[model samples]
Target chain A: MTEKKVYNVAIVGATGAVGQKIMKILEEKEFPINKLKLLSSINSAGKELVFNGKTIIVEEAKPESFEGIDIALFSAGGSVSKQLAPEAVKRGAVVVDNTSAYRMAENVPLVVPEVNNEDIQKHNGIIANPNCSTIQMVAGLKPIKDAYGLSRIIVSTYQAVSGAGVNAVNELENQSQQFLNNEELEANILPVKGDKKHYPIAFNALPQIDVFQDNGYTFEEMKMINETKKIMHDPELSVIATCVRLPFFTSHAESVYIEVDKEGVTVEDVWKELRNAEGIILEDDPSTQSYPTPLSAANKEEVFVGRVRKDLDNDKGFHLWIVSDNLLKGAAWNTVQIAQSLIKNNWLQG
Target chain B: MTEKKVYNVAIVGATGAVGQKIMKILEEKEFPINKLKLLSSINSAGKELVFNGKTIIVEEAKPESFEGIDIALFSAGGSVSKQLAPEAVKRGAVVVDNTSAYRMAENVPLVVPEVNNEDIQKHNGIIANPNCSTIQMVAGLKPIKDAYGLSRIIVSTYQAVSGAGVNAVNELENQSQQFLNNEELEANILPVKGDKKHYPIAFNALPQIDVFQDNGYTFEEMKMINETKKIMHDPELSVIATCVRLPFFTSHAESVYIEVDKEGVTVEDVWKELRNAEGIILEDDPSTQSYPTPLSAANKEEVFVGRVRKDLDNDKGFHLWIVSDNLLKGAAWNTVQIAQSLIKNNWLQG
Candidate 1:
């Protein structure tokens, strides 16, 4: 048997929701790793995490933590990624950041592997993972855009609570339990954790996702609009988005309306392209009630697309429902995929 | 003191979700009624419902039951409306129908009092109340359309389970309790209860709001499309809808995208129109994190419009967040409003 080359891997924010998912996914994928290190804030120091039957002790992340690391996956808050990602890069480690810190930076590559993996080669020692909702969306729509060309896009997301990180998930669970028990529902960590106000997500939907921008669109909406154009390399695709946080705990689902550039693409044509696309599973049999729900798509790494129908009024418009596990496909798996793509294609350089 | 004139009133399907709301609204409005007649299907016959501290038995609906009813509100079902509305009209009752039976019938006026109260004058005995989702939407959009001519509309609804009926509400409660208990959920009523498949709606969303039409659009979607055009009196205006059944038990919320004929309309312009529009409550301050969720809009008589913003890409297009108690403003209150309009305007020729 030919020996496979391995490299040293480290995970920043080792105790977070997405960070933990990254650890499990890396193990499940059995990525070629010679050594594994876990790093977090000093508050999490001495805490241990398991990877491939070995207990790895977490140390405080700093400039020295990435000295010999080949690749570091980051899922800490934006501030942590902003402070440490450059440090990691300076010490010869390529970073796949899962925060909004570097996504829109001119030199950084905001990549969804299925949509814009080639952009990874243009990175300056760091590749930014797109937002959880944006990741599955670009992946689902890229095949259609490639097959039939594209004109405009409008998306409304039914996002999961886990996208807001660990405390938000706990808030949802706690609020749900309170709601069922007829107790007072608390709202301390939702809509936007640092915003001026908080709202309960138990049995309710909030239209604001992230903080409101001066122009009235939420930051999450702007991230979707900007990142999609960047990943697709279309500066003028006329993209619009409404991001709403639902009560779901796992997967993020989107209702997408797309107007193809080509005039005569039918629903079957889109279906054919989706079925042949990688990292996509077409679940669209209306007769059999085969479509993706958050529960059905939970813990899965593939983007599930369904409800493919041509617009009743417009010949060029099509509607679709796309769903995926926000933690797996949206954050952790995509982060690991970027690392895998870099290693396999020999595109990593620091 | 001069005596006020009182008319005999009847409520068809008096035990139904919408009908119960109508009964309560009539009492709250202090409608001038000499006698109240409650009618329902034989399945619910002999059920005594209290209104204004008086018990009224729900009799099986018969054609002769409308003998002296000056204004009859019908919400039983489409077939029941088709059979009984005309008979009520023959017996000198002006029917404000809450079903889809006579909605598209020629000479039958579809009225959302805030949108087109004048349409009630053209009614030949039966004035059709628009669909629940459609009523709230048109009521919310009418002011904007009146101030700036509307060219196109596309709406996606986050509709509640109660819009399906009372049994769907029970299913949601039962399924939610079952979900909380870690037991398997049973879904017998949702997303068109008579359909072959029964998917749980406890913590999930079902995209199929009604049975699928041959054109791939659900009937509920078609209703919103057709009813919007009809109530707005603009057959040439393009309208499209995607209705999804959510887990909430009360209000139906909509994300509406509109393209206007007039250009340069700002978010402030839309807000000004909504603030002054009748039957619409503007709840749109991002600073305060104010917007209508289903829970916030439940049991309210007015439609709530918020999150108003101009589309970033389309200059003439705008987005709106509209919510309302589907049973109140969407059905019962609208029905009572139509009856009030008839009485005030002397439009009930029958």
Candidate 2:
């Protein structure tokens, strides 16, 4: 019989929304862990969090925080990851970064385990998690693409406030109550927190997700466009994204239109592939009024796909609704799965 | 100065959501009404409503109610329009229907004043108003289509609860409050009041907007697809839609992707055309984070368009976000505008 191995695991930004979910998911998954360290910024330091019945105090993350850590999961801001990721890597800790800091880096492998788990072997001490919207989308599309080759994608996202963090979720709650009471909605954080402008996200849809790039696409839209190609290893693919932030607290629902390369692909053919794929649930039955909604998908780890229909005009075109919990599968669950893959594949050494 | 001719006008379904908005718009526009009549179902017949400082008693609509009426606006329901519209037309009254009863009727002209006002002249005593979601989309696209010929359209709508009328709006409000209070949401009206199943719309996205058709498309989705082609006077235009009911109470927003037949169309070209168009407001500015949201577009009559971008890959493809009040420009204002156009163009004799 082979002996089981457990390694020390560390979670950066442990007090943040995604970081907190990471703690819960790690405990729930019963990950093999010899030790666990919770680290955050100076403001969130000293916060106590329970993991697997043990209370751990979040320590201020520094370069030495990774000295004894075998794996580090980062979900802090991009700048924090930019500053601390290499420092942790220098201390011999493999990182599965959940920020956009190192996603497009030439050496780093941007991955969604369901789509491209083998990419973990190419990691140079850092495996990048794609954007929340991109992760669910690619996870849903990977199955269809495998059955019939994919050429183009156009998606419009109905994203939740939780994707922005815990503060944004609180802002939505406060603004919604204020709206119901006929009080003026106070907008402190939304659309983009660090951006110059702020908009109330309660009972409204904000077309902007991240900061706008020079090309007129928001950073979130560009991430979906670029990271999708990188993760799918298809540089020639045509992808476009419109990322909008809605007032929901959890889960993102996307309306995706794709053009497969092959001809004679019916809805059933696509459904067959999706049903056979891992980490995907097909909930489409028009007769029964069955489909996945954001509320139904909240807290779920697998991506829920529904509203599958072949386009009336184009033989290659198909539309799908893809949904999942932004905190779980989109970030925390995906990050933890990469670490598990790393350990199982014996690819922890970069 | 020419003395404006006043006519006897009747408003059917005066107590409903769109009906109430119609009253407000009629009073605000001062539609040169010599005598105004309010009519509704027998259940709401005795209710009192005020219009322009005049208290009016609602009367039950019957076959003979339109005896001397020069114009009648119908918004009660499809069954009411199906039964009362032809009777109203038979009694020397021109009917502007805000229901789906005659939208696709071969002889009926489904009209949006900005896009196809001339279709009003072709009306045979009945002018059908386009769907709320369709009205905003076509109004925003009319200019772009005229400038660079339109070939195909793909749209995903974030529609408000009010589009389904007052009951659905109340469902959203009650569900929202219940959700906030940690109580179970009782959803009796949503997605479609007539559909078999009901789902809560508070803080959630319902992919099904209306009852599903056998083709895997909802009735709302089919409305957008079929109405766009009919109003554009192009039978060969490729159109596809996915309609979703969101939690908001006022406006309908659409993320539209279109392919122009003409090549070399730039973002500025599209913006210029939208700015010059009569019913569209161009609010696209990436640097200032300027774009129209549902809350911002509510209660306005014109269609607000923003986030216009040429597709990154397809030269002829463009993406736009279109928004407007589902009641104002979508229903009440557009219906009133058709009546006004009939009076102006002297087409009431049809």
Q: Candidate 2 lDDT, tens digit per residue, B181-242?
A: 99999999988887899988999999998888989999899999999999999989999999
Best by lDDT: 2
Per-prediction DockQ comes to: 0.64, 0.90
Give stretches of model 1 more than 4 Å off.
none
- Residue lDDT tens for model 1, A71-122: 9999888999999999999999999999999999999999998998899999
lDDT for A201 in candidate 1 is: 87
TM-score of chain B of each: 0.98, 0.98
For model 2, the stretches where C-alpha displacement exceeds 4 angstroms are B1-3
Model 2 lDDT on a 0 to 1 scale: 0.94
The residue pairs that clash in candidate 2, if any, are: none
